[model samples]
Target: MHRPAPTHAKHCCSLPSPCKECFLVSFARGGSWRPPPCPLAMGNTKWADAGQASAIAGRRRERLIPRSGPPVRSECLDGKRGETGSPHQLEGKTMKAVMYTNRRADRILQFTSDFPDVDWAVVWSPEEFENGVADADLVVLSNRICTPELGAALARGRTDRLRWVHFSSAGIERGVNMGLPRDIPVTTSARAKAPVCAEHAMMLLLASSRRIWEIRENQQRHYWARNELNFTMRSIEGQTLVLVGLGGIGAEVARKAKSFDMRVVAVTRGAAPTPDVDDTVPRRRMCEAFADADAVIVATASDPSSFRLIGSDAFAAMKETAYFINIARGEIVGESALISALRAGQIAGAALDVAEDEPLDPKSPLWDMENVIITPHVSAAGSTNDYFRLRALFAENLNRFRAGRPLDNLYHFDDGRALPATN
Candidate 1:
C-alpha cells in the first residue's frame, strides 16, 4: 500500500523518515520550537563528541531559504518510456534493482512507484545485500553503508548481473575509500541537491564572517562581547569568494555570491565558463585565485586525484585575514595542515561542514578552537523539496537507462568522479 503525501501546508509538522539520517530538515515556528532541531541539544555540546550521530547545529541553525522556481512534477511509472534519446535501450527486458538502505518504508514505496516495471529488492542489512547482489541488475548505495565487505563483494564479481551503481549523495569518496570497483558506471544525486548545499556554503561563510561562533560562546557564559565581535565581524559584500569547483554546487554558490555583491572566482576542471562567476581558472592555477580571495570555499568533488589537495601549500598561499570554508569532503583538505594554519593564524578562521575523519576524534584541536566553526556534515540538510527532486531524477534516469540513453549525473569511473550530465 502506498503512503499518501503529507498535507501541503505552508508549515509541516511531519518529520522525514530515518529521523537520525544526516542532511535532514528542521523548520521553525513563531518563537516556540516545534520539535527540537538536532540531537545536539543533548549533553554533548562539543561537535566532535557527538560522533556520527551529529545533527546540524540545533534550533539556532539557519534554515535554507526556499528556491524561487516551479515545483517539479513527479513522473508516473506506466511503461511509457521517456522521450529523451538514450544510448542504451533495454528493448523488452526488465531490470532488477536492489536498494540497500535503512530508509525502508518511504524510500521503498517511492522507488516502487517510480520504477514499477523493474524487480525491486530492499536490503536493509549488509548481510542481505551480500546474499542478494548476484541477481541484482542495479544497486543504489548510500555513503554510510558502503562497507569493505560490500565493496569486495561488488569488486569480486559477486554480481555479474550488476550493470550500474547509483550513489545517493554527491561525495563518493567513501566508496572510493571502501575500495569499490571503478569499472561499473555509477551515477549520483549530486546535481539534484546542489542548491541546498550551496545555500549551506553561504550560511557557513556568513556565520564565520560575522563571528557567530564567538557570539554563541559568549552567550553561554553571559558575557557581553559586542566590542570583541565588532573587531572580528566583516561584511561579505565587498569580499572575494573563490569557489574550488564550477559544477552544480559551485555554480549555485557563485549565483548566490553575486547577489551579495561579492566577486566570484572559480577553479574548475576545464568546465565552460558559468554565468555568475567573475572569472575562471583551471584547478592547477587555483592558488592564484586563493591569494586574492577573502574566503576560499572548497566545493570540489573528492576523488583519487583530489585527496589532500588543500595541504600546507594551499593554506600558505591564502591571505592571513582570509577565512577558509569547506562544504566539500574533508579529505580534500589536510586536517593537520588546517589545524596548524589556524593555530599559527595563517588564516583568520575556518568553517567546516565535513571533517577528515567524521565523528571527528574527540581529541581533535578543531573542536577547541574559538576561531573555528565545526558542523557535522549537515550542510546538505533542510531541503524539503529534495525528496521529490531526487525521485524525479531517478525515475527519469531509469527511463533513460531502459532506453540505453546516457544517464544524468553519470559517475565517470575513469575520472573517479561524477561527470556533468550529458542528457
Candidate 2:
C-alpha cells in the first residue's frame, strides 16, 4: 500500500519530542509504529537529560564510525582542507540541507536536533521542493520522486555551496537517467537494504526447493499429504547455486547460502573471487555457469547493459530441474522468454519479487502460472530497522561532509550508471 506524499514542508525548528498521543496515532495507522525517543531524554527543549541522552547519543556516535575504517578519497576534498579527520574545522559554519522523502515530516524532523549547526528542511510538495533545492548546501532525496523536471531543477540549482547529493535508497539508476548533474558528489545508502533483501532471496529459495505453495494448498484443503510431499520435495543441501552479481545484497546472499551447505558460483564482470563463492565465472561465460547450477539468482544492478540480459538463450542453458529466482530488477529479465521457458519446462519454477512492469497486470499469464510465485516487490518490507539504518547513514555522511571527509557509498557516473561504492 502506498501512502500519498505529504503536501507541506516541515522545518526542524518547530518540531517537538514525540508525545504519547503521537505513539497512539502511529499505532492506529497499522504498521507504522516506530518507538519514539525516550520522553525523559527529549522532553525538554534543550535535551539536557544526561543519562538517557548520553546512552542514545553513544549509539548514534557509534554509527558514525565505519565498520572497516574511515573511507578516503582525495578527489572528494578541497585542497585547502588538508584531509584531516577532525571536527574542529566546521565549528562555526552553518550548512543547509533540503530533503525530499515520503516519510512523515515530523518523524524525520526529530533527528535534526542532533545537527544543530545544520538547517534542515523536509519537503514533500513540489512547490516547496523547488525552492528548497535552490538554496540547499546539501540535498537528500528519493529516486522515486526525482522526475526529469526535478532533476533538471537540481542541475540548474547547483551552486558552489552544494557539496553533495544523497539518495535515501540504494538504487539511483532512475535518478541518474533523469539528468542529475554530473559535477556534484552523489551517495547512496546501499548496504542498508542488503540484509533484509538477502533474507527475502533466501526465503524464496527455500520456498521453491520445498514446493511451499503445494504444501500450502494441501493445508488449505485439510489434507495430510506428508507421503506425497516427501516424494516431491527437494533439499537445497549440496546443490549448486549461481549468483549473477556480487554487490552488497548478492554478497550477503552468498554468505547465507553457504550456511545451507550450497555450492556458490558467482558470475561477475571482475575476475576476483568473492568471499563465499566456490567458483568465479566471467560475465560472458554466465551460460556455462548456468548449466552447472541447481538454482540461479539474479542480483545485478539494472542498467542499459543488463536490460533483458536473461532471456531464452540463458534459460536454455539451465537444467530442466533448476529453479530461477530474481530479487533484482525485472527489466533485467525477458518476461516473455521466462514465461515460455517455464511453459516448456526449461526450468522447474521461478520466484520473483519484481516484474518487468510494476503493479503487474492482473491479467498477465505469469499470475496464473502454477510454476511461478510472485511477490509484489515487497522483499525490503517488514523492517523498521532499515529506516533507522538509512537515517544513521545520512547523519554519518552529513558529519563527513561537514568535516570535508570522503562520504560512504559514493556513486560514480563514468559509465552512465550509478556504480555502487567500493567501500
Candidate 3:
C-alpha cells in the first residue's frame, strides 16, 4: 500500500546540521517496542485514519513503520520497500527519542545527561517491545543497546515526528552491522574525529619522514641506523602531498600539511575547492595525483561504495618514490593490493593508523616490511576530554535541534549511503 512522505525531512538539513550524531548513543531500546510519537508527525498528511488522534494512538503502541534493515543507510541494496524507501531528512526541530539501556545504567544516564530537555524514558529491563518505548519524538541507541531485536525495534520506532539520530562513536558502521533502515536521518560523530585524526596524520607523516619507527626497530636490534644511508631523514618542507577524499579528516589533514610547507592537492567526490586544498580534483583523477605527489593521504570515511577505493591500479600509478599514509578507514585501500605495492616498491613506503582488520595479526606480512609503519587505531587517541569534546559538540547540536534552528554535520543522502557531498 502507498503511504505519504515524512513531513519533518523537509526541514532537516537546512544550514549546517552539525549536532545530530549523538542521538544514537542515547536510544533506549526494547524488544518489539513502539516508537514515540514524533512532534513533527502531526504535520504529516499520512495519518492512519482521520480523527484517530495521536493522543489515542499514544495510549496504545502504534506501529508506524517496521524495522527490517540496517540502522543507518540501511536502504535495501535492491530498492527501498514500502513508503519509507526514499530518503527523508529531518531538520529545524529537536526530535524526541527514548534512549535504550541494559546493564550499563551509568553509561545510559551519562549518554542522555547532556540532553536534559529531552523527555526520556528509562528501562531497567528490556521487554519484547516495551510498547511505550516509541512514545517519544525519536530514539537514542546507547552503547548498551545492541541486538538484532533492538535493531528491528528501532526501525519500527522511527517516525516523521522523530527528526534526529546520533551515533556515539565516530562510526555508524556498527548500525550498518545491525542492518538499520537507510530511511532514517542517521549521522555519525565523525565530525568530532577530524581534529584528532588531523593530529594523527601529522604524527604518521612525521614518523615516516623521520624514520621514527625504523630507528626504534634498529635500536631494538642493538644497532644504530640514524646515520645510515636509507635512514637519512627528509624534511617535510617543500614536499608535494595529495590527499584523497577531502572530507572532515582530509580537510584537517590539509590544514596540518601546511605546517611543513607541503603543497596539498585533494581528490574527492565533492569536486569543489576546500579551504586548505591547493587543487580539488575528482576521484577519477586520483591516480594522476598519486604520480605527482611525494606523499598521499587517504582520510575518507568508510561505506560500501568506499570499500577498497584505493587499490592495485591506483598504487601502480603512484610515483615509485612517493610515500603513502592512511588516517582514514582501512577498507578504503585493498589489502592484497597494498601489500603488493610495498613488496614491489610501487610506492616508496607507507604508514597506517587503521587496517583492514583489527589487531592486525602477528602473522600479517605487513608487520615484517621494513618501509611500512603501523599503529593500532591510536591516531585519534588524545588524553582528557577528547571523547567528551566530540560528544559535547553533538549535544550542542541536539540543543540546536530542539530549538528548530538549522543543523550542522548533515550527512549527504545519496540513493542510500551518506556521502560527504551534499545533495
Each candidate: RMSD: 11.6, 11.3, 15.2
Off by over 4 Å in 3: 1-96, 100-111, 121-133, 141-150, 156-161, 229-231, 415-423
> Model 1: residues >4 Å from true position, as ranges?
1-93, 103-109, 156-159, 179-183, 221-227
lDDT of 1 by residue, 1-423 (tens): 112232224213333322221122121000112333222221211122112232332322222221112121222233343422123324344576788877754443465544555677787766778777777778887776777877776665445667788877777767877776566667887766777898999999999889898789899999999888888899999789999987768888998899899999998887777778889988789788899999999999888778898889889999998999999888899999999999999999999998998889989989999889888999878886566456556755665566566776777756665664443
Query: Per-residue lDDT tens digits of candidate 2, residues 289-357?
Result: 999999999988777778898999999999999999999898999999999999999999999999998
Question: lDDT tens digits, residues 1-423, model 3?
Answer: 224534545422221221121111211111011222232232332323222222121243222331112111111112221122223234544334565656553433554544444455655534533453555556555432556776666666555565566565555555665665556456555555566788888888888788786688778899966568364677789888999876657777888888778899998877457656788878788888888888888877677768889999899988887889987778788988999999998887899878898778889899988889998988767633345445444544454454444444545445223433121
Name the TM-score of candidate 3: 0.68
Clashes of 2: 0
Return the TM-score for candidate 2, rounded to 2 decimals: 0.76
Q: TM-scores for all candidates?
A: 0.76, 0.76, 0.68
The candidate with the higher TM-score, 2 or 3, is 2
Residue 423 error for model 3, in Å?
15
Error of 2 at 108 (Å): 5.6
